[model samples]
Target: MRASVSTGQDLGMPAIYLHLLAELLNTIGVDEQDLLLRVGLDPARLQSTNLRVSQPQASEFVTRAIIESGEPGLGILLARELKLPLHGALGTAVMSSRTLGDAMELVTRYLTLRVPHLKVSKRENGSLAWYLVSCGIDLGPLQGFIMDAMLFGCVSMGAQLTGSVVDGLRILRRGPEPAYFQRFRARIPVPVEFGATENALVIPLARLSLPVRFTDDQLAASSRAQCEEALQQLTEDAGFACRVRRVIETSYPFPPKLARVAGTLFVSDRTLKRRLHEEDASFQQLVDRVRLERAADLLRNTAMNLSQIADALGYADAANFTRAFKRWTGTSPSQYRNTWKAAGVGKKTAERVPVAG
Candidate 1:
């Protein structure tokens, strides 16, 4: 019941990033060593198509490359290298999308398949302003390195489709780069903020309706059915924990305690035990897993204290919450807060545990 998205199955390496990286390096006259240094990629791992790169690594690759290459106007540099129409399978899919909105939906929804570690979100800020937000755990040291390529690619594709420029394009980076602000305009006339809310692409609402060549009930139905089937299979495989996570997400601000959750699912407390038994999970185990995930997000994103967090998570008291937090992570809430505070990372709760359907 949690309104969260997940992959039914993990896809292999993200071809988009790899392709873009190859093109980008070639365009800039940067080789494997340059890329390896930028992305923190091991030389041996670079050759494998199946090797996965974390979002952080992708970010690092782009961020560092700009700094190291002395190509302050890096977005334009990479944009020049991208052939938006040549994205092959991905391009074909977008070309078939019904509306620009629909095309964007498909791309972001399936971005995980292309790059499993990166999560993308789109939000309407005003009548004509929309933000395409991308965030995820960085792949070690390569935080934000590939972002320049990815953002430029998006803009390039937009321009190719409309044969014009986006009303605005910008970036919110992890750290300050004095030259980047000037370079941003040279590449695209959008206002660039160094430490903005998140990495996002701004688009006009009018452009969202621009016609794309791709659309068919048949394709939509098939894709939907395949996605549904895959999700169902994953849920079955993960068993009760999946259901429990779903339940927690859906029940946010009123997350069900064990007894209440069991009651609503049409099972007696005892029956709940038996079912979880068959699934090789206990109610407490499910709860703990959900709580740990939720806690991680909160610690990373919020200033809520131990007591407030504990209370929010349905803990009996601050002490109880601290004990549980220590168990879930190796450190206590205070220590975690102190470390991240020193490191200058913002905190955010992952999301409420997902509730079952």
Candidate 2:
């Protein structure tokens, strides 16, 4: 099977993430050298946080690590190890913010430095605050692992910032409830709602102003300066393909409209078009890429059939999904699955109706 949707371009993720995964493996008494190699990453090189690897490399690494370690809740475990200073200057800035609200503002502003492939923002209504998140690329089967880690990381980082649980916080996760969701709840005592409209952390508005225990105006100012510069550099370094891909990834009900995606990104449709042009990409290209990758992942990872897979991928019908799949891979969906099954590898997919979340 293809390792990931990405073409092994883009500095995919900071080396720290892969390294942390390695540590997670170590803790579980599993050897990680082969897992890293499966994705063209060297175990030794991951020791330096400055190194970069392609998005596919990181995604494949995570998938393989999860399979090998038999830990579906790897994301939650990884989040626990990401304490302060682990996020670099972004952590410094977050640590010194005046209050939980301020820290969150800084986090939404600078989180890209830690994980550029995602966009998370904070929105407030009358009595609730939402830490809304959207992916910048298709995560395929790894979506659960990635989203779990990110939401759980937010909880962990929140506690570090405020020196408290930052009470009255709950998680709103997209997709069905995986059995592993409880791993996150175990680490951070918070309510989690699955099959939600979006991926977010819902908080009581009252908790937003809780004081950050170690706020320092001077440190925050300096760290913010560094974070701003780093954000600019990383923005260009990471490229916009993943950013656009993320829009496709998080759009619920399969594909989202281009104008809607632009609006979500806080840009005019025309501007969104122009920016994608500069990246030598387009909305349709990203949509197809995400859809195709997700289709393959579903076939390989889930027991969903062609029709069910088609529905999940936003196809109007199985025939349409079959045509698209053949065009994308040179073979039909059944052909692809049969070929893999014949090879005696991949997920042990069986016929079963998916349970309602």
Candidate 3:
């Protein structure tokens, strides 16, 4: 399978981040599963680190999560829970970086791999270095929540990378501080300044040389290579074909029709076909790709029988599903499940296993 999607437009937020937000909602006594379903998102899809939820869907879900949880500071809470490894390859690259400066540079270059809407730019002045963060899209109500998660997440990450909070670090926010910030202010390691010209993380120039706690030169090189490849794939996947795939991936009733997928993307059938062809993709190919992925996941993780799995993937019957599975993977669905089970891999482990294209 391809390591990442190839380029045209912004693909969307990584599903893992949304999954983390859902977990936060659960901790706050909200029915996160229901909230996701109501927003037309599949809870299962969020489990895949490699998948991305479309921007509109992700925006709606986050908006509702805030309203339902009645917590505007959920972003800060979310940041506190962001362990380094949850960031995927970027996390690995950062963790294994030689110095805080190197890690921050990696983040500035490849943050789009994780958060499509946000970008970080570096500016240096006498004695101080500022990492200014700005959003590429109009986040509106989500602006505060995202900024809180991002800037605080950086603070959290920095503390994790270095054994201590680097001296003289601070956070800058553009608007007046929100009322809820007081609840988190005590836990935040760095001082925050409000009513600033831009949102940024400020640190002394000398701190940039602070060595990362877990730096490994070999791991750093390999992971940075992975980040570069992922970045390329992400940029390549931004085209019309990718947008259509996003629709199909999240659509209800499994294996959505071409017209439905096209309509969802606001293009007619002919135009959709032409655009996808321009990207060297086809409607059925995209649908098959999604089906194959879902099929593999269901086979490995669920005890659902072939018949049930067939129905789930919109196949006519078990035989058809089995044949399709064999065609896609060179093995039948039952054999696939048995092989995975025989390996003693659990559902959680299976879920983390990236499917080859």
In terms of lDDT, which candidate is strongest? 3
Give stretches of model 3 more than 4 Å off: 1-8, 250-253, 256-274, 277-280, 300-304, 326-357
lDDT of each: 0.56, 0.74, 0.84
> What's the alpha carbon RMSD for model 3?
5.1
Residue 33, model 2: lDDT of: 72
lDDT of 3 by residue, 1-357 (tens): 212112214467778888999998999999999998787677877877788877666777889999989998988999988889989999999999999999999999999898776889999999999999987666556667778888899988998999887889999999888898899899888899999999999989999999999999999999999999998998888787787788678766577789866655556899999988898899999998889888887887778988999998998999999887788777777777888889777545445333435
- Writing each residue's lDDT as its tens digit, candidate 1 over 33-104 gives 656543334443333332344333334455566566666555456555566344433455565566776767
* CA error at residue 193 for candidate 3, angstroms: 1.1
TM-score order, best first, reads: 3, 2, 1
Q: What are the runs in model 1 whose C-alpha is more than 4 Å off?
A: 1-16, 31-76, 84-89, 168-177, 193-195, 213-357
Candidate 3: residue pairs that collide? 1-357, 5-233, 6-236, 6-237, 7-235, 7-236, 7-237, 8-238, 8-239, 9-238
Q: Ten consecutive residues with minimal summed lDDT in candidate 1? A: 2-11
**Comparison by lDDT, 2 against 3, better one:** 3
